[model samples]
Target: MGERVLVAHQPAYWPWCGYFSRLLDVDELVLLDHVQFSERGWQHRNTVADRYGRPVRLTVPVRRDFGQRLTEVRIAEPDFRERHWRTLSETYRRAPHFNRFADRLQELYAQSWTHLVDLNEAVTRLILDALDLKVTLVRTSGAPPSGTKTAALVDLCRRHQADVLRVGTGAGAYLDAGLLERAGIRIEVAAYAPTPYGRARSRPAGLSVLDLLMHEGPRARAVLMAGARTAPFTSTPREVHA
Candidate 1:
């Protein structure tokens, strides 16, 4: 049997290229939806390039509670769907491959999503499908309880039978290496250098996957996997036809 690698992260709204880059190398991905929702975090917003090629943030307005799990957070504004779609249309209509994905994009936005986690997961899945990534996705909300912090992470790995726990470099600050090692899980910190794509004059470093797709089209997945520390699961590229 091949090495079982598990990667887990909060399901970010319209996640950036680096998010997909991390997924490229993993066998399974667990969306940590049981975690507390943060208002200022990427759980409800992400950056994109505007019509003028400047980075702009597109956010989903959510009703907040003092201690709400991400899966429990509700959308504060019902019109967020129309507003976000309009923003994307106005900003990216001129992008090379925008029309290619526009129909499906519009369909996604048209769905009535009441919870923040549902919306984020829907979009994440859409982007993953577009990238042709085949990793199995799991949600922590449905998984067995795994204590808290690093302990929870290690437990998650154990539950999934992961020999290696892959995490982004940022996790180095918070995740205890000794704890994971003691739990019999090897730690691999992903070193991802973003691969530049598209013909935009002003390229932003970490815009959402939408930006990459609209610009690079069929080549977006290749660009995303270019500089990763580990090789992606599949080398056969899927063609994105308009």
Candidate 2:
């Protein structure tokens, strides 16, 4: 049987291009919906260019409950969809590829959504399709994960029958690779350093994947994957968790 490779992360809002780069090759991508929600994380906010071609943030207000998991978090406002769509449409209306993806994207925003993670999945799926990535999408909400940090990650790999656990470098500093190696999971880390791509605008690098798609269109896949590198399976993590 072919080796099953997997990647997982907290589902994000209109995630930056870096989020999707490493996901391209994985057999499964798990959304960590069962994990605790992060109020200041990208889960509820992302940046894009304004009509004036400057960086602007679109934030989703959530009904805050301390210690609540992402699956339990709810959108605090009802009008955010319309407002966010307006911001996107008004800003990218003139983008070379906006017309190609505008309709479906508009329809997504038009849907009534309650859970923030559900909304995130809807958009991330669309973006993945746009990039032509065929990785199977799963969420921890389907099968509750066990443990915390690397233990949790190893449990996820075992649950999914994954032979390789390919994680983003965001967690590299804290991963307990030795634990995973002992569990018989080969660990690889994917990293992307933001580089200039066709501009949806003059906003700083690391803007949402929308910025890449609107400007680069079909070639956005290559642009998103550019400069992305994966660290080979390391017997040791950069740092060991206690």
Query: Local distance difference test, per candidate?
Result: 0.82, 0.84
List the candidates' TM-scores in order: 0.91, 0.91
The parts of candidate 2 lying over 4 Å away from their true place are 199-203, 233-242
The clash count of every prediction, one per candidate, is: 0, 0
Model 1 misplaced regions, further than 4 Å = 230-242
lDDT by residue (1-242, candidate 2, tens digit) is: 78788788889999998789888777568999998999889999999986566898999989989999999999999799999999999988988899999998899988999999999999899999999998777989878878989999899989889888887655667788789889998887777767676653345877898888888889988876665777775544453221
Residue 26 CA displacement from its true place in model 2, Å: 1.9
Model 1 weakest 10-residue run by lDDT: 233-242
Clashing pairs in 2: none
